[model samples]
Target chain A: MKLFSVEKPGLYTTYQDLGRVGYLKYGVPASGALDRFALQVGNILVGNERGAAGLEVTMQGPELLAEETFVMAVTGGDLSPMINGRRIPLWKSVLIKKGQVLEFGQPRQGVRAYLTVSGGFHAKKYMGSRSVYEPAGLGRKLEKGDELVGEPRQQKAGTGLFFTEIPDYDRDVDVRVVKGPHHEQISDKVVSDFFAMTHDVSPQSNRMGYRLQSDLATNHEANVISDGVPLGGIQLPGNGQPIILLADRQTTGGYTRIGTVIGPDLPLVAQLPPGGKIRFKEVSVEEAQEAAKQEEQKLRIWERFTR
Target chain B: MKITFYPLGEAAVKCCFHEDISTALTYNIQAFCKKLVHQKHVGISEWVPAYDSVAVYYDPWKLSYEEITNVLVPIANEMDAHEKKTKTVITIPTVYGSDYGPDLENLAAANKLSTKKVINLHTKRHYLINMIGFLPGFPYLSGLDERIAMPRLESPRQSVPAGSVGIAESQTGIYPLDSPGGWNIIGRTPLKLFDAEKEEPFLFEQGDYLQFTAISEDEYKQIQREIEKGTYKLERREESE
Candidate 1:
């Protein structure tokens, strides 16, 4: 039903899912929800598929007016969701009636938030995903006066869905990383300095990458043969600044990549605000695998609990 | 080609080949990529083959890095034992110089050659699709004539139109989409390299061979119209080899 009409599109709101997979060879970026954990939780709360497309509100959120009855859940950065001027709790399903306005106030924590409804947001699936990848012209950011359709009701009203452990958006973040394929190409001093320094997220950081700034001057030539760049790649351009590739990163890059953030810890970088401080810690591949396994187990338990 | 496997994050593994960019390395990369896809490895999500490396993104839940590396080693080594596959040859019609090619005169002057000679040198050799990156459907081509090798612009244009045939250093390629690039454009093609709405989405695949056939501006417009109407089909044939 075309019930959810966007009254005020927030700062950079778009529809995203679990990314468009299996198209990297064509240079397509796996555009998906930056905070996958939050998106899964939000979807599960509303009894939707894990890969279902949902609105990813960044910093600010849209003022949506519902013209029908539906169940919705807000996850990720607590963007202060409210219904009809009354604040609503996050991490749990809430009911919305006809003519009710769903609005968000200033973000209380984190940079991105996910709003998933019963029956996923209906969007044109391009290359196996409903994610809005502006580069490919698949879909674009949410604009005012846009009518969004959702699936017919497949879920009943839900309640009492809450996580015991909420992600702390204000905590000092240590982004765990595995050494990149070309880590040896850089000087040992540069590597040491990189780990020792506390980097601040640059203002220009986006879904493509997080450009970090540090006072340390890393004077090294970072000219490597162009090669495949994986998600979370910490590439150090010739300018000594480090850019950590993220969800919308290019398929390949030529700068020297020193390390890649571990999979489980990617959400920490994703949730970090523009002025957030981050320190990199190098860990073994085995450690990264263990962390990912633990995260999966936690999500599985959460999924079961919500069900 | 000697291959070495390295862990990339928790779910991906990167296979590094030779450090140099050569046709042999590209072929080895392609052979392994083809074998990997044909074998239908269970957990492999995607394989991105660039200048000298292939980064395989996989599902950690279904497969581990060690298991993936173990399966990849033998497949990479036994690539030659498998039957050699034929490549798809694609002809890209291009309009060189004038408005179609804003930098053709400067490129000719930089190479100490006439515009006609530059066009001949570019069209004489077939280009190998070494890698696909930078932008969606943008092919990184090789086999450019070193004599006409031109450096990239000091500062790249804010935006270059799609289908622009450009050269940078010793490599030549076409901008599949309107993106910011530093390559020196010498011509424009009439083909739409990327259409996200299409079922296939991409016109050319990695390892496909491309031959540029120069055409007049009028012909370029005609082909463009046909492409818009879905009447123009990109000419393709199986390589004799």
Candidate 2:
């Protein structure tokens, strides 16, 4: 099976999965989907396994040509779709016919969209991943006039695939964090003020990190060696703006982490676009993990709830 | 080689050494990383290796942070014991001037010497790999001659091409990919520091020793053509000392 060449590529379109994990030792950034939950939803809709590589089109999307037949699904954000210039709603499974043109027009709401194919695209997987790290030019962002060849679907669903209920994804999400190892070094007043303050996501934020600007006070050691930084670690620079680590962040960092946005809440952090405002509440490590499991359970229940 | 355990998150623990980067410390990280990857520990997914530290991501249900840290101390000490046996030396070939090496003359003049002198001093020293980071396969090499210390460019260029030999902050490194960089370019090497197409994408790994040798522009072109033709072979450096 084959996917058509891109007639018009919009914004940033790239291949992504859960990410390139276990390669930080050689300084490879773990490049993956910004919103893993959204990506999973898209994959699940098409009956693809979670963590399978797919198209992560941000806000504006590419105009694609479909060369062969396959069950495709789009999940994430509120972006209107068009098949051969006809309007189609998002978050629902759509059967793409052979030689038809598919495109995502202007984003009416969310900043990201996830599109998943049946068997996943046939891309060269490096280090057990097909996620492209654009900076490294390994698996690059899908560019204009690029022909995409997809792998054949492995599962034969004798009954054509379709999902009845669209997922209920809340745009407004609150993320919780755990106080970091260096949290105490930063004043208690700052910690208290941080929880009290609400921050707006700066335009400066991207896959590498999320930079938030707020009235919250900040502090950092001028001379510090780099250390292994966990995902969602909130580091406050000397300038007072807080930077949260993401999938493509460096293996180690020199900044001071005020808190670590727990694992479960990391998906919430990923969905935030520039100018998004949010606040963080502190929780214990044990509580963080428990919340993660609970959050996972809630996600599983989302499908059942709609059904 | 000995490291203290610190909890990074519920699923991972960081093993950090005391301040300072060196060969011995890098070796310790290598040995520990080797062990962690091979062991069938419950919940331990993978360990990320670095110059003076290792970030071990594990499953909380299988192994606690305390358990991984407790197992790491003895292995860290053991890596130091076998450092001599695992020590490896690698040499890189470089060409001095022309279109390939754009900033060679400037770096040579800044050091109050001819371009030849700069190349001689750079190639003469046997440098140790401190760590690999900043970019894929980009190594932070220590033991540079203090005389050639040069600060990074006042304003970094938007893209420094691959295999660009650069110096900054009394240290030297090669740009593995075309990225926004400020390092002072001394010369360019035709060697592929990074190649995603290969079995081992990175030609050089952490903790390995490196030596540079001077080559001609013709030789550079020859290597480039051969590399494109898939017949280029780089000479290996024998490791004893």
lDDT by residue (A163-223, candidate 2, tens digit) is 4434333445577877865775777888888888778888888788989887565554622
lDDT of 1 at A38: 86
Superposed Cα deviation of residue B12, candidate 2 (Å): 3.3
Q: Model 1 off-target regions past 4 Å? A: A305-307, B80-86
lDDT per model vs. reference: 0.87, 0.75
Compare the candidates by lDDT and give the number of the best one.
Answer: 1
Clashes of each: 0, 1
lDDT of 1: 0.87
Assess every candidate by TM-score: 0.96, 0.88
What lDDT, from 0 to 1, does candidate 2 have? 0.75
Q: How good is the docking of model 1, as DockQ?
A: 0.81
Query: What level of docking quality does candidate 1 show?
Result: high
